[model samples]
Target: MGYIAPESPISDYDRDVVFFEGDLEELDFEVLQKGMELGFILEQRQTKTGDIEWVARDVRKFVAPPEKKVIPIPTSTKSKANPESPVNIYPSSYRTFLEKLSDSLKSIEKINDSGNFEDAVFSLLRLLGIHSVYQYSRDAQAGKADGFFILENLAVMYDCTLRNPFEEYKKDQIENYIHKLSNKSQLTIETRKADGGRGSKTLQIQGKSRQVWIITKGNTRELLVYDSIKVKEVAIKDLITITIEHCRELSYDAEHLSSKLVMLGD
Candidate 1:
């Protein structure tokens, strides 16, 4: 929520990068504190074009991350960026932004659900480079995989737990749905192969890879999820591939239980 102004008697890094920008500046101190505790230094300023540019002041608070990064770029707005080219982010700015967004998604604020959900998701997807609509959700239908992705020949179904009060999703329910999809998809291939289906060779696999993603119900607040994904994992010194928040029942909305995919792209 707090960003370091490069010239605010802070430093001469010209790193005036607003990593954790947005309405998050008005977010509660505790929520911001929780983010910092999760090892998300949300307001890091990366010196993209200068020497003696940046320096790490300290390790105020850190915590283990529990969800995917959610980066929010205004699609309705225009940028100097090229649509055909990849999106570029300064290291510091990206890291903090993701942390907040991911946390917001996990907490499921009503804000995210408002307006166009697809636009928000798609915007983040483009940031993640995991494009393609693998599954679509008919929110009225429960126990069904709402949305998914077909990445690298593998399909991932998600029962998005992104909802209000920040509650932990029921693992059993998640497991049940994903298992069903895995089995159903596998069976279709088997039955088809036996019936002389066209792509028998492609379908003849011992098991298909399945990824079960759990996004959130909705959020109206500024989410810094995109800021988190780019953080460095201690053990690997590399950014974590998957982050899981601690499972606890913070809060819930029964109606918005499952409705999105968790995309993992190579």
Candidate 2:
């Protein structure tokens, strides 16, 4: 990831900033290249007093990579003797990652059987390359959502339930979940002052609205209501498939993969 400081005079910025110092001179070419390969860029710090400073931001936030280059379609093999050989469209590392993830997801039944669905799901998400995921939870007394995961500026709030009692989930339940997640919370971030120094800024986690999703092994239509709220539902196996197929895709674009969701329903 890379970030660019806004183009403005240092005199107009807020003062009283604090930030961690790092040495760029110590980095080798391989280290820098690896960082770039992982979709990161070095961002110049906005401090007025320091020499040119740089920080890292997630590349996906600022850069739009060409789809064809990032996700090529599978091509047929020329050799007939081994026609069954898999065609890898993405990088070898990504392919291997997906393979391992698929293997783990293939055992979802066993995972649930051992009463480890939540842990297994969390592990699967991490394996599928979702960074900074929180374990699933619901605090009715505290009024918090079941769970949430972040992707840049977006937060996806979700609830998980088993297949048998899916019909018991209602619109009011979904509303409560959304309401709980939308509550206010504060986060501290580094800011630059006009005098070339830094300060901390406290911002609310409720800055942006979140998307809602439901994970289950049951029918999604059961949650349909008369109200106009939109929700996405996915069966466990379908979630695994979607995660593997578009693991690199941002959570914001998940709706585009709806065609695959129907197939999983079959």
Candidate 3:
């Protein structure tokens, strides 16, 4: 019903106060009276030109809307695979190995050996049908990745952490890995003994769909910062679930798991 006068120079009034002109309609007058009754202070001032102005003070403060809660997707149980599905077939030894790995990961906190954790993760990936997986040597140069695997067109460089609460050094290691990725097109990594014991191999990663991930048995909320850099943090339990699903039906291979990781990050 009233307007903030354009010609009302702010310099002519006190800070946090707005000047309004024109007649207040019935509804507007009622609202103003109710506001004053609710402790809002209103003042009237006469300008040098005899113009009457209304100054409203002590207006309501702005309150921000509450943040939306993010509910994590619960991990699902493995479903029965079709007997006719060719992918459902696997060797007895492979099934035994999967069982053992899954058991070890369940009590990961009890395992003081980081090497065992890393090995279990690497073996699990291989068993999941990713043929191009390689584990990096512990003696490799600084800023080197712990391991990497190729999933069809996607290449993922990853590091493993056994810390339950997730330490800062692990995060620093991931940042270093990101920096390494940014600087190099090809990464030289040692070949695993299972892959013919080759001395070393150069992975050409430039122009490929690349992702950096931290496979940790720790809290993953800390890794949210890397989401913008295409980094994913997978909890140890989730990895075990993925492995179980794969072992059951050959459902989640490296490419499928990588895509699932992207979804989890989002």
Candidate 4:
């Protein structure tokens, strides 16, 4: 696409502050056509900001994907846990562990307050260095998110839980979130690298990943993790030895889960 600047100057942060400055007139038919399918508009439009008044139009567009976007995943990927997978997360020592886990999940964008345990887990993941947002609320004011974390270049949605959990519940919950995330969306797109060596598949391309995080809650519990082209479900449990073992194999920070299930009595 091409453009005719206002002659003043457009900085990189134009989108952040300018609201709308893209000169769609410069956009070629091909680019505009592609942009439209990608959720963009090339026609002229107007808007009013707090104080800055400016006439802007052109190819600048906001791509809002459908509310229910379907996400697909590969088959080779599967949960790695066996009967011998040792777990180290338990209620006895979960408090100290969880306090630390909470500290690590600082990037969580939203937290569900109702019976939805996933929201709480989203917040916890952000503390654990996993970037995530929740999208359960459909209100216009509600932001876009359904417990997604920044994994690689893709935003992965995850079903979250911390209390009253077992492997069966987690497995079902994961599938539910997967269904929710895949309700609607454009075909898979690729995310380009800064170096541009090999472009990776993007959030728009293929399907996004939906993960399950069972916050260690209460005492010992049982769980499972299963994934395939059809559906993905993970069994979850609170047995410390089992959790630690699974963490070792899955490579997730076992220490985090252990800290979360810390119970004073357990």
Q: Highest TM-score: which candidate?
A: 3
Candidates 1 and 3: which is better by TM-score? Answer: 3
How does each model score on TM-score? 0.30, 0.43, 0.52, 0.28
- Model 4: residues >4 Å from true position, as ranges? 1-120, 138-146, 153-155, 167-172, 180-210, 216-266
lDDT tens string, model 2, 154-222?
Answer: 555556655466435445667775554544464333433345465554545555434566776654442
Q: How high is the lDDT of residue 189 in model 1?
A: 19
lDDT of 3 by residue, 28-71 (tens): 43345422322223455667898545565444322444554444
Q: Report the lDDT of model 4 for residue 49.
A: 48
Stretches off by above 4 angstroms in model 3 are 1-110, 140-143, 192-198, 219-228, 250-255
Candidate 3 shows a clash count of 0
Error of 2 at 32 (Å): 14
Winner on lDDT between 2 and 4 is 2
134 in model 1: Cα distance from truth in Å?
A: 3.2
> How much lDDT does each candidate structure score?
0.36, 0.48, 0.60, 0.36
For candidate 1, what is the lDDT?
Answer: 0.36
Which lDDT tens digits does candidate 1 get at residues 87-178?
44534455466677566553423344522453344334433334443334343335554455444444544444434443234445554654
Greater-TM-score candidate between 1 and 2:
2
Please provide the root mean square deviation of candidate 2 (C-alpha atoms, Å).
13.6
